[model samples]
Target: MAKTLKSWLQILLKLVNSTIGIVGISMIIYSMWMARVWQRHMEGSSDDFFSFSVIWFILTFLGIGITLCAISSFGHIAAHTANTHCLSCYMVAIFLLLLVETTLMADIILNSDWEEDFPEDPTGRFDDFKDFVKSNFNTCQWIGLFMFLAQGCSIVSATFLRTLEKRQARYCESDEDDIAPSLPFLYHPVEPLPCTVADLPGAPSSLYWC
Candidate 1:
Protein backbone atom coordinates (compact mmCIF):
# COMPACT_ATOMS: atom_id res chain seq x y z
CA MET A 1 0.00 0.00 0.00
CA ALA A 2 2.85 2.36 0.82
CA LYS A 3 4.48 1.58 -2.54
CA THR A 4 1.27 2.33 -4.42
CA LEU A 5 0.75 5.53 -2.48
CA LYS A 6 4.31 6.64 -3.23
CA SER A 7 3.83 5.90 -6.91
CA TRP A 8 0.71 8.04 -7.03
CA LEU A 9 2.45 10.85 -5.17
CA GLN A 10 5.27 10.72 -7.68
CA ILE A 11 2.76 11.05 -10.50
CA LEU A 12 1.18 14.05 -8.84
CA LEU A 13 4.56 15.69 -8.41
CA LYS A 14 5.35 15.13 -12.07
CA LEU A 15 2.05 16.70 -13.08
CA VAL A 16 2.70 19.75 -10.94
CA ASN A 17 6.20 20.11 -12.29
CA SER A 18 4.93 19.85 -15.85
CA THR A 19 2.28 22.49 -15.22
CA ILE A 20 4.80 24.90 -13.73
CA GLY A 21 7.21 24.30 -16.59
CA ILE A 22 4.52 25.10 -19.13
CA VAL A 23 3.62 28.30 -17.27
CA GLY A 24 7.26 29.33 -17.11
CA ILE A 25 7.61 28.87 -20.85
CA SER A 26 4.47 30.88 -21.46
CA MET A 27 5.78 33.68 -19.25
CA ILE A 28 9.02 33.76 -21.22
CA ILE A 29 7.11 34.09 -24.48
CA TYR A 30 4.94 36.85 -23.07
CA SER A 31 7.99 38.68 -21.77
CA MET A 32 9.53 38.54 -25.22
CA TRP A 33 6.38 40.00 -26.75
CA MET A 34 6.36 42.73 -24.12
CA ALA A 35 10.00 43.53 -24.84
CA ARG A 36 9.23 43.88 -28.54
CA VAL A 37 6.31 46.20 -27.86
CA TRP A 38 8.40 48.31 -25.50
CA GLN A 39 11.17 48.49 -28.05
CA ARG A 40 8.80 49.69 -30.74
CA HIS A 41 7.33 52.27 -28.44
CA MET A 42 10.78 53.50 -27.46
CA GLU A 43 11.83 53.75 -31.11
CA GLY A 44 8.98 56.17 -31.82
CA SER A 45 10.03 58.44 -28.97
CA SER A 46 13.25 60.46 -28.82
CA ASP A 47 13.04 62.11 -25.37
CA ASP A 48 10.29 60.37 -23.43
CA PHE A 49 12.47 57.38 -22.53
CA PHE A 50 12.54 56.40 -18.83
CA SER A 51 14.24 53.88 -16.55
CA PHE A 52 11.20 51.66 -16.95
CA SER A 53 12.46 50.44 -20.32
CA VAL A 54 15.73 49.33 -18.77
CA ILE A 55 13.88 47.51 -16.01
CA TRP A 56 11.64 45.78 -18.57
CA PHE A 57 14.65 44.67 -20.59
CA ILE A 58 16.24 43.22 -17.49
CA LEU A 59 13.02 41.42 -16.66
CA THR A 60 12.79 40.05 -20.19
CA PHE A 61 16.22 38.50 -19.89
CA LEU A 62 15.41 37.18 -16.43
CA GLY A 63 12.24 35.56 -17.77
CA ILE A 64 14.19 33.76 -20.48
CA GLY A 65 16.72 32.58 -17.93
CA ILE A 66 14.03 31.34 -15.56
CA THR A 67 12.26 29.46 -18.35
CA LEU A 68 15.45 27.69 -19.35
CA CYS A 69 16.25 26.90 -15.75
CA ALA A 70 12.78 25.45 -15.18
CA ILE A 71 13.05 23.23 -18.27
CA SER A 72 16.42 21.96 -17.14
CA SER A 73 15.20 21.40 -13.60
CA PHE A 74 12.21 19.43 -14.82
CA GLY A 75 14.51 17.24 -16.88
CA HIS A 76 16.66 16.61 -13.84
CA ILE A 77 13.60 15.71 -11.73
CA ALA A 78 12.46 13.29 -14.44
CA ALA A 79 15.85 11.64 -14.14
CA HIS A 80 15.27 11.36 -10.34
CA THR A 81 17.97 13.75 -9.10
CA ALA A 82 16.75 17.30 -9.29
CA ASN A 83 18.86 20.13 -7.76
CA THR A 84 16.59 21.93 -5.37
CA HIS A 85 19.19 24.59 -4.76
CA CYS A 86 19.21 25.60 -8.38
CA LEU A 87 15.43 25.63 -8.44
CA SER A 88 15.39 27.86 -5.40
CA CYS A 89 17.84 30.23 -6.97
CA TYR A 90 15.71 30.45 -10.08
CA MET A 91 12.62 31.14 -8.01
CA VAL A 92 14.32 33.95 -6.13
CA ALA A 93 15.57 35.48 -9.37
CA ILE A 94 12.09 35.32 -10.86
CA PHE A 95 10.60 36.97 -7.79
CA LEU A 96 13.03 39.84 -8.07
CA LEU A 97 12.33 40.21 -11.75
CA LEU A 98 8.58 40.30 -11.17
CA LEU A 99 9.05 42.90 -8.45
CA VAL A 100 10.94 45.09 -10.91
CA GLU A 101 8.23 44.64 -13.51
CA THR A 102 5.51 45.55 -11.04
CA THR A 103 7.40 48.63 -9.89
CA LEU A 104 7.92 49.84 -13.45
CA MET A 105 4.29 49.24 -14.36
CA ALA A 106 3.19 51.20 -11.30
CA ASP A 107 5.58 54.05 -12.05
CA ILE A 108 4.32 54.43 -15.62
CA ILE A 109 0.72 54.49 -14.46
CA LEU A 110 1.02 57.01 -11.62
CA ASN A 111 3.37 59.64 -13.10
CA SER A 112 1.77 61.75 -15.83
CA ASP A 113 4.11 64.23 -17.52
CA TRP A 114 1.75 66.56 -19.32
CA GLU A 115 3.57 69.40 -21.10
CA GLU A 116 3.15 71.20 -24.47
CA ASP A 117 6.37 69.62 -25.78
CA PHE A 118 5.11 66.13 -24.98
CA PRO A 119 5.51 64.11 -28.27
CA GLU A 120 2.03 62.62 -28.23
CA ASP A 121 -0.94 64.93 -27.59
CA PRO A 122 -1.52 64.92 -23.83
CA THR A 123 -5.34 65.00 -23.98
CA GLY A 124 -5.87 62.35 -26.69
CA ARG A 125 -2.82 60.17 -26.21
CA PHE A 126 -2.96 60.58 -22.46
CA ASP A 127 -6.55 59.33 -22.37
CA ASP A 128 -5.74 56.43 -24.64
CA PHE A 129 -2.53 55.76 -22.76
CA LYS A 130 -4.45 55.96 -19.52
CA ASP A 131 -6.85 53.32 -20.74
CA PHE A 132 -3.98 51.17 -21.97
CA VAL A 133 -2.19 51.64 -18.67
CA LYS A 134 -5.34 50.83 -16.74
CA SER A 135 -5.90 47.61 -18.67
CA ASN A 136 -2.30 46.49 -18.15
CA PHE A 137 -2.29 47.59 -14.51
CA ASN A 138 -5.41 45.59 -13.77
CA THR A 139 -4.68 42.53 -15.83
CA CYS A 140 -1.09 41.80 -16.85
CA GLN A 141 0.41 43.16 -13.65
CA TRP A 142 -1.82 40.95 -11.56
CA ILE A 143 -0.91 37.99 -13.70
CA GLY A 144 2.75 38.71 -13.06
CA LEU A 145 2.11 38.87 -9.34
CA PHE A 146 0.30 35.55 -9.41
CA MET A 147 3.04 33.92 -11.41
CA PHE A 148 5.60 35.13 -8.91
CA LEU A 149 3.57 33.73 -6.03
CA ALA A 150 3.13 30.43 -7.85
CA GLN A 151 6.85 30.13 -8.40
CA GLY A 152 7.48 30.67 -4.69
CA CYS A 153 4.90 28.06 -3.74
CA SER A 154 6.37 25.60 -6.21
CA ILE A 155 9.82 26.06 -4.74
CA VAL A 156 8.56 25.31 -1.26
CA SER A 157 6.66 22.28 -2.47
CA ALA A 158 9.65 20.91 -4.32
CA THR A 159 11.85 21.28 -1.28
CA PHE A 160 9.37 19.45 0.93
CA LEU A 161 8.91 16.63 -1.60
CA ARG A 162 12.62 16.17 -2.06
CA THR A 163 13.17 15.89 1.68
CA LEU A 164 10.30 13.42 1.97
CA GLU A 165 11.77 11.21 -0.73
CA LYS A 166 15.13 11.18 1.00
CA ARG A 167 13.51 10.27 4.29
CA GLN A 168 11.56 7.45 2.61
CA ALA A 169 14.73 5.99 1.19
CA ARG A 170 16.36 6.07 4.62
CA TYR A 171 13.33 4.47 6.23
CA CYS A 172 13.32 1.67 3.68
CA GLU A 173 16.95 0.91 4.33
CA SER A 174 16.38 0.84 8.09
CA ASP A 175 13.31 -1.37 7.75
CA GLU A 176 15.22 -3.90 5.70
CA ASP A 177 17.90 -4.00 8.38
CA ASP A 178 15.30 -4.53 11.11
CA ILE A 179 13.78 -7.53 9.27
CA ALA A 180 17.16 -9.07 8.52
CA PRO A 181 17.17 -11.37 11.58
CA SER A 182 13.89 -13.17 10.76
CA LEU A 183 15.04 -13.66 7.17
CA PRO A 184 18.42 -15.03 8.10
CA PHE A 185 20.24 -17.10 5.40
CA LEU A 186 17.98 -15.38 2.85
CA TYR A 187 20.95 -14.91 0.56
CA HIS A 188 22.77 -18.21 1.41
CA PRO A 189 23.04 -21.19 -0.93
CA VAL A 190 21.14 -24.48 -0.22
CA GLU A 191 22.05 -28.09 -1.20
CA PRO A 192 19.87 -29.82 -3.76
CA LEU A 193 17.60 -32.78 -2.80
CA PRO A 194 17.66 -36.28 -4.40
CA CYS A 195 15.98 -36.23 -7.86
CA THR A 196 14.13 -39.55 -7.78
CA VAL A 197 12.52 -41.95 -5.21
CA ALA A 198 14.73 -44.80 -6.40
CA ASP A 199 17.75 -42.88 -5.11
CA LEU A 200 16.44 -43.39 -1.53
CA PRO A 201 16.65 -47.24 -1.39
CA GLY A 202 16.27 -47.40 2.40
CA ALA A 203 12.93 -45.54 2.42
CA PRO A 204 9.62 -47.50 2.91
CA SER A 205 8.45 -48.72 -0.54
CA SER A 206 4.66 -48.64 0.32
CA LEU A 207 4.93 -45.15 1.80
CA TYR A 208 6.92 -43.98 -1.28
CA TRP A 209 8.72 -41.26 0.68
CA CYS A 210 10.50 -39.10 -1.91
Candidate 2:
Protein backbone atom coordinates (compact mmCIF):
# COMPACT_ATOMS: atom_id res chain seq x y z
CA MET A 1 0.00 0.00 0.00
CA ALA A 2 2.80 2.40 0.77
CA LYS A 3 4.46 1.60 -2.51
CA THR A 4 1.26 2.27 -4.39
CA LEU A 5 0.83 5.61 -2.67
CA LYS A 6 4.38 6.57 -3.43
CA SER A 7 3.90 5.62 -7.09
CA TRP A 8 0.84 7.83 -7.32
CA LEU A 9 2.58 10.73 -5.66
CA GLN A 10 5.49 10.47 -8.08
CA ILE A 11 3.12 10.45 -11.01
CA LEU A 12 1.36 13.51 -9.64
CA LEU A 13 4.64 15.36 -9.28
CA LYS A 14 5.66 14.53 -12.84
CA LEU A 15 2.39 15.85 -14.19
CA VAL A 16 2.68 19.03 -12.15
CA ASN A 17 6.27 19.61 -13.23
CA SER A 18 5.59 18.96 -16.90
CA THR A 19 2.48 21.10 -17.08
CA ILE A 20 4.11 24.04 -15.34
CA GLY A 21 7.27 23.81 -17.44
CA ILE A 22 5.38 23.81 -20.72
CA VAL A 23 3.21 26.71 -19.65
CA GLY A 24 6.21 28.66 -18.42
CA ILE A 25 8.06 28.16 -21.72
CA SER A 26 5.06 29.36 -23.66
CA MET A 27 4.69 32.41 -21.42
CA ILE A 28 8.35 33.31 -21.87
CA ILE A 29 8.10 33.01 -25.63
CA TYR A 30 5.01 35.17 -25.78
CA SER A 31 6.51 37.81 -23.45
CA MET A 32 9.76 38.01 -25.44
CA TRP A 33 7.88 38.38 -28.69
CA MET A 34 5.80 41.18 -27.24
CA ALA A 35 8.92 42.89 -25.95
CA ARG A 36 10.43 42.81 -29.40
CA VAL A 37 7.33 44.37 -30.89
CA TRP A 38 7.38 47.10 -28.26
CA GLN A 39 11.04 47.74 -28.98
CA ARG A 40 10.34 48.21 -32.68
CA HIS A 41 7.58 50.65 -31.89
CA MET A 42 9.84 52.64 -29.53
CA GLU A 43 12.72 52.67 -32.02
CA GLY A 44 10.66 54.80 -34.44
CA SER A 45 9.94 57.41 -31.78
CA SER A 46 11.88 60.63 -31.25
CA ASP A 47 11.59 60.53 -27.47
CA ASP A 48 14.86 59.99 -25.61
CA PHE A 49 13.05 58.50 -22.61
CA PHE A 50 12.58 55.15 -24.33
CA SER A 51 15.60 52.96 -23.74
CA PHE A 52 16.59 49.79 -25.56
CA SER A 53 18.25 48.65 -22.37
CA VAL A 54 14.82 48.29 -20.76
CA ILE A 55 13.77 45.94 -23.52
CA TRP A 56 16.95 43.98 -23.08
CA PHE A 57 16.31 43.71 -19.38
CA ILE A 58 12.84 42.38 -20.03
CA LEU A 59 14.25 39.91 -22.49
CA THR A 60 16.84 38.78 -19.97
CA PHE A 61 14.21 38.00 -17.40
CA LEU A 62 12.17 36.11 -19.95
CA GLY A 63 15.26 34.19 -20.96
CA ILE A 64 15.82 33.23 -17.35
CA GLY A 65 12.26 32.00 -17.17
CA ILE A 66 12.85 29.82 -20.22
CA THR A 67 15.95 28.35 -18.68
CA LEU A 68 14.02 27.54 -15.55
CA CYS A 69 11.35 25.82 -17.56
CA ALA A 70 13.94 23.73 -19.37
CA ILE A 71 15.44 22.60 -16.10
CA SER A 72 12.08 21.49 -14.76
CA SER A 73 12.47 18.27 -16.69
CA PHE A 74 15.44 17.42 -14.54
CA GLY A 75 13.32 17.89 -11.44
CA HIS A 76 10.72 15.47 -12.75
CA ILE A 77 13.38 12.91 -13.62
CA ALA A 78 14.93 13.21 -10.19
CA ALA A 79 11.63 12.81 -8.39
CA HIS A 80 10.64 9.77 -10.42
CA THR A 81 13.99 8.08 -9.92
CA ALA A 82 14.27 8.97 -6.23
CA ASN A 83 17.85 10.19 -6.71
CA THR A 84 18.99 12.26 -3.74
CA HIS A 85 21.63 14.31 -5.54
CA CYS A 86 19.36 14.91 -8.48
CA LEU A 87 16.60 15.98 -6.10
CA SER A 88 18.96 18.47 -4.53
CA CYS A 89 19.72 19.90 -7.95
CA TYR A 90 16.03 20.04 -8.70
CA MET A 91 15.38 21.93 -5.49
CA VAL A 92 18.02 24.47 -6.42
CA ALA A 93 16.46 25.02 -9.81
CA ILE A 94 13.06 25.54 -8.26
CA PHE A 95 14.51 27.96 -5.74
CA LEU A 96 16.16 30.03 -8.44
CA LEU A 97 12.97 30.19 -10.41
CA LEU A 98 11.05 31.25 -7.37
CA LEU A 99 13.57 33.96 -6.66
CA VAL A 100 13.38 35.40 -10.15
CA GLU A 101 9.61 35.37 -10.17
CA THR A 102 9.36 36.97 -6.75
CA THR A 103 11.76 39.68 -7.81
CA LEU A 104 9.64 40.39 -10.87
CA MET A 105 6.48 40.62 -8.81
CA ALA A 106 8.17 42.95 -6.40
CA ASP A 107 9.39 45.19 -9.21
CA ILE A 108 5.94 45.46 -10.68
CA ILE A 109 4.16 46.01 -7.41
CA LEU A 110 6.55 48.55 -5.87
CA ASN A 111 7.43 50.85 -8.74
CA SER A 112 5.20 53.91 -8.42
CA ASP A 113 7.46 56.36 -10.31
CA TRP A 114 5.61 55.85 -13.56
CA GLU A 115 2.81 58.00 -12.16
CA GLU A 116 5.13 61.00 -12.18
CA ASP A 117 5.40 60.83 -15.95
CA PHE A 118 1.65 60.67 -16.34
CA PRO A 119 1.20 64.40 -15.82
CA GLU A 120 3.84 65.65 -18.33
CA ASP A 121 2.63 64.05 -21.56
CA PRO A 122 0.98 66.48 -24.03
CA THR A 123 0.22 64.00 -26.82
CA GLY A 124 -2.00 61.69 -24.76
CA ARG A 125 0.78 59.14 -24.64
CA PHE A 126 0.15 58.34 -21.01
CA ASP A 127 -3.56 57.78 -21.54
CA ASP A 128 -2.92 55.70 -24.62
CA PHE A 129 -0.43 53.57 -22.73
CA LYS A 130 -2.86 53.02 -19.90
CA ASP A 131 -5.62 52.13 -22.31
CA PHE A 132 -3.43 49.68 -24.18
CA VAL A 133 -2.34 48.04 -20.97
CA LYS A 134 -5.84 47.79 -19.61
CA SER A 135 -6.99 46.16 -22.82
CA ASN A 136 -4.04 43.82 -23.39
CA PHE A 137 -1.10 43.94 -21.00
CA ASN A 138 -3.20 43.48 -17.89
CA THR A 139 -3.68 39.82 -18.75
CA CYS A 140 0.06 39.44 -19.10
CA GLN A 141 0.61 40.66 -15.56
CA TRP A 142 -1.97 38.22 -14.26
CA ILE A 143 -0.25 35.44 -16.17
CA GLY A 144 3.03 36.37 -14.56
CA LEU A 145 1.40 36.21 -11.16
CA PHE A 146 0.03 32.79 -11.99
CA MET A 147 3.51 31.70 -13.01
CA PHE A 148 4.74 32.73 -9.61
CA LEU A 149 2.10 30.60 -7.96
CA ALA A 150 2.85 27.65 -10.19
CA GLN A 151 6.56 27.83 -9.41
CA GLY A 152 5.74 28.00 -5.74
CA CYS A 153 3.65 24.87 -6.10
CA SER A 154 6.50 23.12 -7.86
CA ILE A 155 8.81 23.94 -4.97
CA VAL A 156 6.40 22.50 -2.44
CA SER A 157 5.62 19.37 -4.44
CA ALA A 158 9.26 18.65 -5.07
CA THR A 159 10.05 18.99 -1.39
CA PHE A 160 7.30 16.63 -0.31
CA LEU A 161 8.24 14.19 -3.01
CA ARG A 162 11.80 14.16 -1.81
CA THR A 163 10.63 13.29 1.70
CA LEU A 164 8.38 10.61 0.30
CA GLU A 165 11.33 9.10 -1.55
CA LYS A 166 13.36 8.90 1.63
CA ARG A 167 10.51 7.27 3.47
CA GLN A 168 10.09 4.73 0.69
CA ALA A 169 13.77 3.82 0.78
CA ARG A 170 13.58 3.25 4.51
CA TYR A 171 10.43 1.21 4.14
CA CYS A 172 12.03 -1.07 1.57
CA GLU A 173 15.08 -1.62 3.75
CA SER A 174 12.92 -2.47 6.74
CA ASP A 175 10.81 -4.85 4.66
CA GLU A 176 13.89 -6.71 3.43
CA ASP A 177 15.24 -7.02 6.96
CA ASP A 178 11.93 -8.39 8.23
CA ILE A 179 11.90 -11.19 5.68
CA ALA A 180 15.63 -12.00 5.92
CA PRO A 181 15.37 -14.30 8.90
CA SER A 182 13.21 -16.85 7.01
CA LEU A 183 15.40 -16.99 3.91
CA PRO A 184 17.65 -19.82 5.14
CA PHE A 185 14.76 -22.16 5.82
CA LEU A 186 12.98 -21.19 2.64
CA TYR A 187 16.04 -22.20 0.52
CA HIS A 188 17.47 -25.03 2.65
CA PRO A 189 19.08 -28.01 0.78
CA VAL A 190 16.84 -31.01 0.17
CA GLU A 191 17.63 -34.58 1.45
CA PRO A 192 17.18 -37.80 -0.53
CA LEU A 193 13.74 -39.45 -0.47
CA PRO A 194 13.15 -42.45 1.84
CA CYS A 195 13.13 -45.98 0.28
CA THR A 196 10.15 -48.44 0.56
CA VAL A 197 10.29 -51.55 2.74
CA ALA A 198 10.70 -53.78 -0.38
CA ASP A 199 14.02 -52.04 -1.21
CA LEU A 200 15.69 -53.23 2.04
CA PRO A 201 19.07 -54.97 1.52
CA GLY A 202 19.23 -58.80 1.51
CA ALA A 203 15.45 -59.08 1.23
CA PRO A 204 14.56 -62.03 -1.08
CA SER A 205 12.17 -61.35 -3.98
CA SER A 206 12.45 -57.60 -3.47
CA LEU A 207 10.64 -55.55 -6.11
CA TYR A 208 13.18 -52.62 -5.96
CA TRP A 209 15.40 -51.98 -8.99
CA CYS A 210 19.17 -51.43 -8.74
Candidate 3:
Protein backbone atom coordinates (compact mmCIF):
# COMPACT_ATOMS: atom_id res chain seq x y z
CA MET A 1 0.00 0.00 0.00
CA ALA A 2 2.81 2.41 0.75
CA LYS A 3 4.04 1.89 -2.80
CA THR A 4 0.95 3.61 -4.16
CA LEU A 5 0.19 7.34 -4.29
CA LYS A 6 -2.83 7.16 -2.00
CA SER A 7 -0.99 5.56 0.89
CA TRP A 8 1.82 8.13 0.78
CA LEU A 9 -0.79 10.92 0.65
CA GLN A 10 -2.60 9.57 3.68
CA ILE A 11 0.72 9.40 5.49
CA LEU A 12 1.44 13.01 4.58
CA LEU A 13 -1.98 14.17 5.76
CA LYS A 14 -1.55 12.34 9.07
CA LEU A 15 1.83 13.95 9.62
CA VAL A 16 0.55 17.43 8.77
CA ASN A 17 -2.51 17.02 10.98
CA SER A 18 -0.36 15.82 13.86
CA THR A 19 1.92 18.83 13.53
CA ILE A 20 -1.05 21.23 13.51
CA GLY A 21 -2.52 19.50 16.56
CA ILE A 22 0.77 19.84 18.39
CA VAL A 23 0.88 23.54 17.57
CA GLY A 24 -2.63 23.87 18.96
CA ILE A 25 -1.57 22.10 22.15
CA SER A 26 1.37 24.50 22.44
CA MET A 27 -0.98 27.47 22.02
CA ILE A 28 -3.23 26.12 24.76
CA ILE A 29 -0.23 25.71 27.01
CA TYR A 30 0.86 29.28 26.30
CA SER A 31 -2.63 30.50 27.21
CA MET A 32 -2.44 28.57 30.44
CA TRP A 33 0.88 30.22 31.22
CA MET A 34 -0.65 33.61 30.48
CA ALA A 35 -3.54 32.89 32.79
CA ARG A 36 -1.10 31.99 35.56
CA VAL A 37 0.84 35.17 35.02
CA TRP A 38 -2.34 37.28 35.02
CA GLN A 39 -3.53 35.58 38.18
CA ARG A 40 -0.66 37.16 40.06
CA HIS A 41 -1.44 40.53 38.48
CA MET A 42 -5.11 40.32 39.44
CA GLU A 43 -4.26 39.26 42.96
CA GLY A 44 -1.92 42.23 43.38
CA SER A 45 -4.31 44.78 41.93
CA SER A 46 -7.51 45.89 43.64
CA ASP A 47 -9.28 47.09 40.47
CA ASP A 48 -12.09 45.00 38.95
CA PHE A 49 -11.94 46.87 35.65
CA PHE A 50 -9.32 44.55 34.20
CA SER A 51 -11.30 41.33 34.78
CA PHE A 52 -13.27 41.36 31.54
CA SER A 53 -10.24 42.15 29.45
CA VAL A 54 -8.30 39.32 31.04
CA ILE A 55 -11.10 36.85 30.55
CA TRP A 56 -11.53 37.88 26.94
CA PHE A 57 -7.85 37.54 26.30
CA ILE A 58 -7.76 34.07 27.72
CA LEU A 59 -10.88 32.97 25.85
CA THR A 60 -9.59 34.30 22.57
CA PHE A 61 -6.45 32.18 22.75
CA LEU A 62 -8.40 29.17 23.90
CA GLY A 63 -10.88 29.48 21.05
CA ILE A 64 -8.18 29.74 18.42
CA GLY A 65 -6.31 26.73 19.75
CA ILE A 66 -9.49 24.67 20.00
CA THR A 67 -10.43 25.52 16.44
CA LEU A 68 -7.03 24.38 15.17
CA CYS A 69 -7.17 21.15 17.13
CA ALA A 70 -10.67 20.45 15.94
CA ILE A 71 -9.69 20.89 12.33
CA SER A 72 -6.76 18.53 12.74
CA SER A 73 -8.98 15.94 14.41
CA PHE A 74 -11.53 16.18 11.62
CA GLY A 75 -8.83 15.56 9.02
CA HIS A 76 -7.76 12.44 10.87
CA ILE A 77 -11.34 11.20 11.16
CA ALA A 78 -12.05 11.73 7.47
CA ALA A 79 -8.91 9.88 6.50
CA HIS A 80 -9.82 6.93 8.69
CA THR A 81 -13.47 6.71 7.76
CA ALA A 82 -12.86 7.10 4.00
CA ASN A 83 -16.47 8.26 3.75
CA THR A 84 -17.25 10.73 0.96
CA HIS A 85 -19.52 12.82 3.17
CA CYS A 86 -16.93 13.09 5.91
CA LEU A 87 -14.27 14.01 3.37
CA SER A 88 -16.54 16.71 1.96
CA CYS A 89 -17.17 18.07 5.43
CA TYR A 90 -13.46 18.16 6.11
CA MET A 91 -12.83 20.06 2.89
CA VAL A 92 -15.49 22.61 3.83
CA ALA A 93 -13.91 23.10 7.23
CA ILE A 94 -10.53 23.61 5.59
CA PHE A 95 -12.03 26.14 3.22
CA LEU A 96 -13.58 28.14 6.05
CA LEU A 97 -10.32 28.09 7.95
CA LEU A 98 -8.43 29.24 4.89
CA LEU A 99 -10.98 32.04 4.43
CA VAL A 100 -10.32 33.30 7.92
CA GLU A 101 -6.57 33.08 7.41
CA THR A 102 -6.79 34.90 4.11
CA THR A 103 -8.78 37.66 5.75
CA LEU A 104 -6.14 38.00 8.41
CA MET A 105 -3.42 38.19 5.80
CA ALA A 106 -5.33 40.78 3.84
CA ASP A 107 -5.93 42.93 6.88
CA ILE A 108 -2.28 42.75 7.87
CA ILE A 109 -1.08 43.60 4.39
CA LEU A 110 -3.69 46.11 3.26
CA ASN A 111 -4.76 47.91 6.41
CA SER A 112 -2.38 50.63 7.59
CA ASP A 113 -3.79 50.57 11.10
CA TRP A 114 -4.89 46.96 11.54
CA GLU A 115 -4.04 47.06 15.21
CA GLU A 116 -6.77 49.65 15.75
CA ASP A 117 -9.34 47.14 14.50
CA PHE A 118 -9.00 44.91 17.59
CA PRO A 119 -9.42 45.43 21.32
CA GLU A 120 -6.37 45.74 23.55
CA ASP A 121 -4.77 42.47 24.60
CA PRO A 122 -4.39 42.00 28.32
CA THR A 123 -1.71 39.30 27.98
CA GLY A 124 0.04 40.76 24.92
CA ARG A 125 0.07 37.35 23.21
CA PHE A 126 -1.03 38.85 19.91
CA ASP A 127 1.85 41.29 19.94
CA ASP A 128 4.24 38.49 20.78
CA PHE A 129 2.84 36.37 17.95
CA LYS A 130 3.21 39.29 15.56
CA ASP A 131 6.78 39.87 16.61
CA PHE A 132 7.53 36.21 16.21
CA VAL A 133 6.13 36.23 12.71
CA LYS A 134 8.07 39.32 11.82
CA SER A 135 11.27 37.87 13.21
CA ASN A 136 10.77 34.56 11.36
CA PHE A 137 8.97 35.57 8.22
CA ASN A 138 10.70 33.07 5.92
CA THR A 139 10.18 30.21 8.38
CA CYS A 140 6.50 30.99 8.81
CA GLN A 141 5.97 31.38 5.08
CA TRP A 142 7.59 28.05 4.30
CA ILE A 143 5.62 26.31 7.04
CA GLY A 144 2.35 27.79 5.80
CA LEU A 145 3.13 26.77 2.25
CA PHE A 146 3.84 23.19 3.31
CA MET A 147 0.62 23.02 5.33
CA PHE A 148 -1.56 24.46 2.57
CA LEU A 149 -0.15 22.14 -0.05
CA ALA A 150 -0.27 19.05 2.13
CA GLN A 151 -3.88 19.53 3.13
CA GLY A 152 -5.10 20.57 -0.30
CA CYS A 153 -3.36 17.89 -2.32
CA SER A 154 -3.84 15.06 0.13
CA ILE A 155 -7.57 15.59 0.61
CA VAL A 156 -8.33 15.93 -3.08
CA SER A 157 -6.32 12.83 -3.95
CA ALA A 158 -7.86 10.89 -1.10
CA THR A 159 -11.35 11.66 -2.36
CA PHE A 160 -10.36 10.59 -5.86
CA LEU A 161 -8.85 7.35 -4.57
CA ARG A 162 -11.92 6.62 -2.50
CA THR A 163 -14.24 6.97 -5.50
CA LEU A 164 -11.93 4.91 -7.69
CA GLU A 165 -11.76 2.15 -5.12
CA LYS A 166 -15.55 2.06 -4.89
CA ARG A 167 -15.92 1.68 -8.64
CA GLN A 168 -13.27 -1.04 -8.72
CA ALA A 169 -15.12 -2.88 -5.96
CA ARG A 170 -18.38 -2.82 -7.92
CA TYR A 171 -16.70 -3.99 -11.10
CA CYS A 172 -15.04 -6.87 -9.25
CA GLU A 173 -18.37 -7.93 -7.79
CA SER A 174 -19.97 -8.01 -11.24
CA ASP A 175 -17.09 -10.01 -12.65
CA GLU A 176 -17.44 -12.56 -9.86
CA ASP A 177 -21.18 -12.89 -10.53
CA ASP A 178 -20.55 -13.47 -14.22
CA ILE A 179 -17.97 -16.16 -13.53
CA ALA A 180 -20.10 -18.05 -10.96
CA PRO A 181 -22.42 -19.76 -13.46
CA SER A 182 -19.61 -21.66 -15.24
CA LEU A 183 -18.11 -23.24 -12.12
CA PRO A 184 -19.94 -26.54 -12.30
CA PHE A 185 -19.41 -26.85 -16.02
CA LEU A 186 -15.67 -26.36 -15.62
CA TYR A 187 -15.31 -28.99 -12.85
CA HIS A 188 -17.62 -31.71 -14.28
CA PRO A 189 -16.14 -35.30 -14.35
CA VAL A 190 -14.84 -36.87 -17.58
CA GLU A 191 -15.68 -40.36 -18.90
CA PRO A 192 -12.92 -43.05 -19.41
CA LEU A 193 -11.89 -44.02 -23.00
CA PRO A 194 -12.70 -47.42 -24.39
CA CYS A 195 -10.05 -50.19 -23.98
CA THR A 196 -7.75 -50.78 -26.93
CA VAL A 197 -6.05 -54.02 -28.24
CA ALA A 198 -2.88 -53.08 -26.39
CA ASP A 199 -4.59 -54.07 -23.12
CA LEU A 200 -5.64 -57.52 -24.39
CA PRO A 201 -2.44 -58.38 -26.28
CA GLY A 202 -1.99 -61.68 -24.37
CA ALA A 203 -5.55 -63.03 -25.19
CA PRO A 204 -6.58 -61.56 -28.52
CA SER A 205 -5.31 -60.10 -31.81
CA SER A 206 -5.49 -56.42 -32.75
CA LEU A 207 -8.12 -57.23 -35.44
CA TYR A 208 -10.35 -59.05 -32.85
CA TRP A 209 -10.05 -56.12 -30.42
CA CYS A 210 -10.98 -53.75 -33.23
- Leading candidate by lDDT: 3
lDDT of 2 by residue, 1-210 (tens): 767776776777677677667876875876666666665666767754245444444554477667867787787788678676787788788787677767755765798674663235433333554687788887967876776676666677777777877887898999999999999999999997766646566777666442
TM-score of 2: 0.60
TM-score order, best first, reads 3, 2, 1
Q: Using lDDT as the measure, what is the rank order of every candidate, best first?
A: 3, 2, 1
lDDT of 1 by residue, 1-210 (tens): 655554554555455455556666665775566556556666856644345434434364456657655653653364244344554554465456556757766665576642332343321334444577577877866765665665555555556555566677789999998988868578677887755544455866634333
Clashing pairs in 1: none
TM-score of each: 0.45, 0.60, 0.69
The sequence of per-residue lDDT tens digits that candidate 3 reaches over residues 10-117 is: 666677667767767887888788777777767857666347664676777777888888888888887766666776787777777777878988998899999999
Pairs of residues clashing in candidate 2 = none
Q: For model 3, give the 10-residue run with minimal summed lDDT.
A: 201-210
- Name the lDDT value of residue 65 in candidate 3: 88
RMSD of every prediction: 9.0, 6.7, 6.2
List per-prediction Cα lDDT, in the order shown. Answer: 0.55, 0.69, 0.74
Task: Tell me the lDDT of model 2 at 141.
Answer: 76
